[model samples]
Target: MATVLVIGASRGIGLELVRQYRAAGDRVIATARDDEGMTRLRELGAEPLRIDVAQPASVSGLAWQLDGEEIDVALYVAGVIDRGHATTPPTQSAFDHVMHTNVLGLMQVLPQVMPMVEATGGVFGALSSSMSQIGPVPGSNSWLYRVSKAALNMAVRSARFDYPKARLVVLDPGWVQTDMGGESAPVTVEDSVYGLRRVLASLGADDNGCLIHHDGRRAASW
Candidate 1:
């Protein structure tokens, strides 16, 4: 069993990941901003902590709390989808909110967790999306959300250069049925998480810096 750290384990994919990891006998350290989610995590035998990814202080507190412990897997599953881009000019508040939480927030949290993963020679993964791809362009809606995810992909790439020994991956969980993916999404949380676990378990230094699909497929482009 490995020691796993899951960020944004409040609900959906994050919540399911916590459950699956615990069920597999891995030690899970989960974080969530909401009370209900934290309670659920505790019920699953995970040590849940309070964290608002948008707030740097909260993330710092978590890092300080963990201190020198080695983490086997650190998965960043926190993100937001702002449909405000569907508007004519797009709402500035909504745009800023997504960028802060999805981009800047990740930038801040990675530093605190990377060392822990490095100590254990483990993997560090970021939850990305297929929509973040530039070439095979999808619909034009949610443009801002797409941009934020694209930026996040780059951030993970940059991390690979710094943590040479650590296996770092950008995971695309497919279009799953969740609060962010919506009811129309074809994949279920169980299916996505199961595939993701397989993909993650198979990662190696050769797979570092690659964008991987939940089913273990790899992509060259971000």
Candidate 2:
């Protein structure tokens, strides 16, 4: 079984990932903002630690805590979505905060977990959205969220090259019906995560730079 570490394991895609990994009998080092909130993950046989991805101190502390643990898979599912555009002219604080939480956040997160995966010759995965694709040209709205995710995709691509021995999948779980995706999205957490697992499980060293979607298909720009 693989040893997996998931940051932002409190709810939504992060929470679902913890459940699926445990159900598959993989050992998980799951993290959330609080112990009380992540009790479900603990009950499912994961060791849940408190990690708020927005804080660099929390993430760095976690790196030290799991310094020697060989992690087979590390999934970064912690992301923020602020839907507004240049048209709306969002407050400076809101725009920057969203970018900080998503773009700058992912940059900080990857380095801390890379050592764990590198130790075991393992893989890494990070969630990106279709909105992030500059090639596709999304309709409207989601200015900051889309831009941050697009930058995240670039970060994943760069990491893929840097960590050539390990397989890295830059994933888009689709329009999932989680809190972030809301009720209107077509894909459920189960459907999205299950499909994503299949895609990740099938990857090899050559798939390191892939930007994959939930249905086992690769993204257009990938």
Candidate 3:
């Protein structure tokens, strides 16, 4: 069995990933920002680690906590969508928060956690969105979110060279039905995660730095 780490495991896709991983007999280290989330993760048999990805110190603390452990699959699933409507510009505060959490936060945590995964010759992945693409944009809504996720994709791709021993990729879980994806999203979290698990299991050295969709077979445009 592999030791998997799911960052931002409080709810939605993150929470479901923890559940599925644990149910599959993997040792999971799940992180959340709140006590409630921690409690729920524990109920599902995950070892909870409290973290606020927007804060560098919390990410550092997690690195310290896992200093000697070997991680097989480290998936960073924490992210936020733009709160403002498509027709209007997003507030400065919302933009800043999204950029910090979705982009800067991943960059900060990558350096700290990647070494652990690399030690085991494993893989690292971050949840990126297909909407991040520029050519023939999928939707005009959540412009800030789109921008932030695009930046996130670039960050992960660029960082791949720095961690040569571990395979790193950006994953688009598809428009999964989560709190972020909303009710109308076409893909259910279960279906997304199921395929995502297959995608993760199938990743190899050559697949490093790719942007992949949840179908486990297709590559997403950068």
Candidate 4:
């Protein structure tokens, strides 16, 4: 069975991924920041790790936790959103909180995990958003969130050069029904994860460093 790692799996897309991967009989090592989230992962048959990606000290211990295993799939799914638009300036604390969780956290995790992925010629997927696209500007409702995901997209693509053995790609999961997506979202969590898994499974060397949509389409532009 493939060994999968899902970071920030407390709820939403991350948690659903753990559930589906475990159901497929893959060995899953999933992370969350609290006891409650740990319990949920355990119930779903995942090897749970406590990881607060927002805190550097907490993330620093990840390498030791997964020292020798070859990971087939590693996903960086931790992120926080900011709803404030460009009409008003975000406070320093707001910017830091969003950037630290969305961009900095993944940057810290990559060094610890990419080697494990490389050992198996694995796929490393980071959850990004189509809203992050700059070519066709979307609405400015969540401008800070847009900026952070755009940065995340760049971070994964740039890091792909260093770990050539691993297929690194950013995933846009679409607007799903979750706490973050709220009640009006059209996509379901199950559908999004299913499509993401299909896309990841089909990735080849040529697809590396690309942004993939949930429906398995490679993005034409950023």
Of the candidates shown, which would achieve the greatest lDDT relative to the real structure? 4
| Candidate 3 residue-wise lDDT, 17-94, digit = tens | 999999999999999999999999999999999999887777778778787889999999999987555789878888
Q: What does candidate 4's lDDT look like per residue over 1-222, in tens digits?
A: 999999999999999999999999999999999999999999999999999998888999999999898999999999889899889999999999899899989999999999999999999999999988899876888999999999999999999999988899999999999999988999999999999999999998888989999999889999
Of 2 and 4, the candidate ranking higher by TM-score? 4
C-alpha lDDT of residue 26 in model 3: 97
Stretches off by above 4 angstroms in model 2 are none
Backbone clash count, each prediction separately: 0, 0, 0, 0
Candidate 1, residues 55-74, lDDT tens digits: the string is 87777787887887799998
Model with the higher lDDT, candidate 1 or 4: 4
CA-only RMSD, every prediction:
1.3, 1.5, 1.5, 0.7
Worst lDDT run of 10 residues, candidate 1, spans 82-91
Candidate 3 local accuracy as lDDT? 0.89
In order of lDDT, best first, we have 4, 3, 1, 2
TM-scores, all models, native as reference: 0.95, 0.94, 0.95, 0.98
Tell me how far the alpha carbon of residue 167 in candidate 4 is from the true structure, in angstroms, after superposition: 0.6
Error of 3 at 24 (Å): 0.7
In terms of lDDT, the poorest run of 10 residues in model 3 is: 213-222
RMSD of 1: 1.3
Query: What overall lDDT goes with each candidate model?
Result: 0.88, 0.83, 0.89, 0.94
Model 2 lDDT tens row, 1-222? 999998777888888888998989999998888867578778778888887777766666877778689889898888888888768877888876777667776788777788778888888889998888887775668887888888888898888777655777789999999989999999999999898888878886667877898898777673
Candidate 4, residue 55: how far the Cα is off, in Å: 0.8
Which scores greater on TM-score, model 1 or model 3? 1
